[model samples]
Target: MTANEMTGGEALAHMLLAHEAGPIFGMGGFQLLPFYDAARRLGLQHHLINDERCGAFAADAYAKVTGRVGLCDATLGPGATNLVTALVESLNAGIPIVALVGNTHRLHSWKNMTQESRQVEILRPAVKEIIRIDHIERIPELIRRAFVVATTGRPGPVVVDIPEDIAHATYPFDETWFEVDSTYTAAPALRTRPAAENLAAAVELLVEAERPIMLCGGGVHISGAAQMITRFAEAINMPVAHTMSGKGSIACTSALNAGIFGRYDRIANRLIDESDVLLVVGCKLGEIATKRYTLPEPGKKIIHLDIVAEEIGRTVIPSVSLWSDAREGIADLLEVLPQDELKERLAKWAATVATRMQQWRVDVAPRLTSAEVPINMARLLHELNLNLP
Candidate 1:
C-alpha cells in the first residue's frame, strides 16, 4: 500500500482522473456529498448545473467536442431518473458517457428509504453497462471498468451506481488496487486493422469504380479518421457526403465535400444516388440518412467499415465488409491503391455534379432574399453559419 487508506468516494475521483474521463457535469445530493468533497480535493473539476437534465446535456456535449468520455454525476432517486433523457440521446447517438449515481445503502434496499429506486434497471436501457458497487473495496476496479466499457467498441454510455454507505466507507489504499488496464483509451481504434484479403478486395472495387462516393458518419470522428478520410477522398478525388452527426469532421469548404446528407440535402442525396460504387465508413446508414433504405441505387457495390461486426451486416449487407475502425480500415485500402492516382476520369463526373449544384443555387438565390418576415429560413441558417471556425 503506497498511500493511506481513503474513502471509496476519493478512489472514484482518483480513478476518473487517471482515465482522463472528467470535468463532471452534475448536481450534488445528500447521499453523494462525500463524493463531491473527494472530487474537489482531487482537483476533478465539476460544472454544477442547476438541474440534472442540464448536467446530462452539458456532459454529452463535452464528450462530443473533446472526443473523450463525458461524465455526469448525481445522487440517488430523482436525480438518476431525471438523467434518463440525456442517457437515451447518447445511447442512440453512440456517444460515450459515464454516469456516477448514488444509490440507497445495501441494508436499506427493500425498505422505503429516502428517495430509493432501482437505479440499475432505469439506466440499463440507456447504457451499454450498469455496475453496482456493494463493497467500497471494489470501487477501484469498477471505476476503471466503467471508463473502458463506455469508450470501447461501439462507444456508448455506462452507469456506475454506488451505494451511499459504500461511498462514505473507507478502503485500504493499495497501489495495486489502482491498477486499471487503460489500453482501450490510450490506444486509438485504428489498432484493430482489418484483414489483408478484405482490404485488397475493397481496394479493387474502388479502383474499378468510375463514380465512387465516401459516406462518412459520426464514427469517422469517433475513430479520429477525419483527416485521413479527407486525404483519401482528395487522392481519389471522390466526392464525400456525411451525416449531420459527422458535419465537423470535414471542412464544408472542401471542393469534394457534398455537405450534410438525407432528404433535405438534394446535392448529397443525388451524389449517393448517382454513384456507381459507395464506400460507407463509420456510419449506421439509418432510415433518416438513407431515406428509408432507398438510396445507393440498390446492389451497387458497397464497401462498409465499422468497429462493430454486428453493425456491419444488420441493415445493408456490404459487398466487402471491412469490420474495422474507420481510420485503420481506410488507411489499409489507401495503401493498396497506386499513389498520386488522382481521379482523372472522375473529374468530368465531379464537374457534372458541381454544375447541377451551381444551377440549383442560382435558381434558389432569389427565394433566399425575397423580403419575407421570417427572413428566409434557408438564408438565415446559411448566413449564420458562414465564416464559422
Candidate 2:
C-alpha cells in the first residue's frame, strides 16, 4: 500500500490518538488482531484484561476517577456481548464511555460465523448510540461522532461496531477527514450556568431562610464542585447533608457536614424536618436519596439545582429550579450573596444543627468505645473515622 493508504485499523488507531483519547482497555480475540497491531504501531497505551466484563469496568473506573471519556473495546461475538453490563451500569450512573466492538464481515453476517450472535442487537438497549460501519472509510467520522454523542448532554455510553472485514480493509486516507484538534480531549461538553432570575430567586430564599440547609449529591462530584460547595456552605453557615454518592464531595469531619442521611439517618431527618428552606445542589433527590420524598418535609421551600432539567422536580416540586452546573452555579451565587453579616444571623441555627451533630457523636460514643467482645460494627467504623484526618 502507498504512504497514504493504510488499513482501516490503522486509521481508527490514528483517529483515537489524534483526539488524545484516554486509555484503551480490552481483551484479545480473533477479530481484533489488526486493531491491536495498529495500536502498538501508533504507540497507543493499551490495557489488557482476561475478561471483557472486567475490562469494561476498569475503563469505567478510569473515567470516573479522571472525569474523562472511557475508551474500551471488545472482540466480535462473545467478547462484545460481555461488555454490556458495565456499559449499562455506566448509563445508570451517567458516566461516559465509548465502546468499540467487532462484528462479522458483511459477507458472512448471519451466516453462522463462530461465536457470532447479533452484536448490535444485543447491545442496543444498554448504550445511547449504536453506530455500525459497513464501509472502512467511514470509521474516522463515526468515531468522532461517537465521542461527541457519548459526552454531550447527560453523558452515557456509545457503541461503535466495526465489522471484521472493514477492520482489515485498506483505505487511501481521505483528505476530507476532519482533522482532530491538538487540544481535543475525551470529555463531556455540558456547560450549565444558572439564569439570573433563578439565581436571584435562590438568593432571596437563602437570604431570608431562618433555618437554611444544603443538601448535596453525586452531581457535586461529577461537576467538580466539592470546594465550591464547602466555601458556599461555610460562608453562609449552612448545614450540609450528603447522600451516599455525595459523601466525598465534602469532608465528613467539616463542621458544616451534618452527615450522610436519607434512608434512616436520625440527625439528618430531624434537621430536614425542621429546615425552613433547603438549597439542594447537584443532587437528583431520587427516592433513596430523599427517603421516598419525605425528607424535604411538607411544603418546605426548596431551591433545586442540577444540570439536567428533568431531574429538577422529578420527585418533589421545587420553589426554584436552577438548571446549571453545580460548580458554576455555586461560584456565581458566591459572587452575588453577601457573607459579612449573615454568618451572625445564621449563628444560632447553624450552631444548633452543629450541636445536634456533636450530640449524635456523643450519644454514639459509648457504643463506639464499648469493650465488649465481637466488636460493635458501628464502633469499628467509628474507630476507622476517628483516626482519619
Candidate 3:
C-alpha cells in the first residue's frame, strides 16, 4: 500500500504491534474508533476498561509486573483528561507507560474552539515526553521516541497525542520504517573495588572492633546484591539491621537479622549507638533511613559502599567510602579476606546476636501474655519465611 493510502489510526496500530506491545488498555470512544479497528485487525488484545482511570491504572500495574512499557489509549477532550490522575500515579510509582490520547482536528486548534483541548500541554509536565503527531508520516518516529523515553533512566509515562482528523487521514504503510531499535540499551555503571591499601586498612579496623553492626539498605535490592550482603554479613558474624526500604533485602527470619533502625524501633536505635563498626552497603543514609540524619557516635567507624559516587558519603562521612556495586564489592572483599579468621568472627557474632534475640523475646513475652489477643512475633516470622522462597 502507498504511504498516502493507510489511515493514521492504522499506522499507529502497526507501529505499536511492530514494537511487540501485546495489549493496550483503554475505553474506546467515537474519536478512537479507527485506532480500535486497526488494533482488532492486527490481533492485538484490547482490554476494554469501564473508565479511562481504570484503564490507565491497569496499564501501570501491567508495567510493574512485566518490566516493559505499558500502553493506554483514550479519545479527545474529556476522555484524555480523565486519564491525567492515573498518569500522575504511574509517574510517581516509577512505571514505564505510553498514553495515546486522541485530539481534535487541525481546524479546531484555535482557543475556545468547540471540543478543542491542548492535550500535549496538559500532559507535558507529568509525562517524560509528549509527541503530537500532526503529520501521519511521523507516526513511526513518534511511536519509537515515545517508547524510548518511557523506558529509559528512571522510567515513567509518555504521551502521544493523535488528532482525530489525522487518525482518519490516509498514510502509506512502510514496515521498514519501524524496524530500528529505539530502546535504551546502556548498562548501569559497574561498582569499582577499593584499592589494595584501602581494603587492608578496612580489614584492620574490622578485625579489632569489639562490637560491629552491618547496616544494609535499599541499594542492595537495586544493585541485585542482596545475596552478597547476606554472605558477607555471615562471614563476618555481623548483626544485620535494615532500613525501612531494605526490609526484605536480607532473610528476615535469620538469627543475624537485628531488625530495622528508626524512631519506630527503640531497640534498634540503642543497638546502632552501641555498635563499634557500621558496614553500610548499597544504602544511602538518607534522612528517613537515618532517622533525621542522626548517626552513630563519633568514635564509631563507618564503611560505606554504593553504586553512585555522590551517594557514598552523603549522610554520615564514612571512614572508608567504596564507590562500587554492593554485591560485587562484598563478594570481592570476602574472597580476599583470611578465610579461617573470618569464619571464627562470624561464629562469634552469630552467637552474640542469638543471645540478644533470646533476651528480646523474653522481654516481650509478658506483654504478649497480657494482651487480650495473643500475638506471636516468632510464629508470624516463621510463617512468612515458610511462605516466601
Best candidate according to TM-score: 1
Tens digits of per-residue lDDT, candidate 1, 38-90, equal 88887889988899989988988888777678889888889998899999998
Off by over 4 Å in 3: 1-5, 76-89, 113-122, 131-134, 180-239, 243-245, 274-287, 295-389
**Reference-based lDDT, each prediction:** 0.81, 0.83, 0.74
lDDT of 2 at 318: 97
* Clash counts for the predictions, in order: 0, 0, 7
Candidate 1, residue 205: lDDT: 84
Give the lDDT ranking, best first: 2, 1, 3
Our tally of clashes for model 3 stands at 7
Candidate 2 lDDT, 1-389, residue by residue in tens: 22478888888888888677778999877566788898998898889989999989988899889878888989988899999999998887777788889888778888888889977899999998899888887888888888877776667888999888888889888645747644225444666799999999988988888888888888887777899999888887888998888887778778777887699574887888889998888788888887887777769999999988998898889999998888899999888987866778888888876688889879888998988899988888878987987
User: Between the candidate structures 2 and 3, which one is better when assessed by TM-score?
Assistant: 2
Candidate 1 wrong stretches, greater than 4 Å: 181-190, 339-342, 385-389
The lDDT of model 1 is: 0.81
Residue 345 lDDT (model 2)? 89
- Could you tell me every candidate's TM-score relative to the true structure? 0.94, 0.92, 0.70
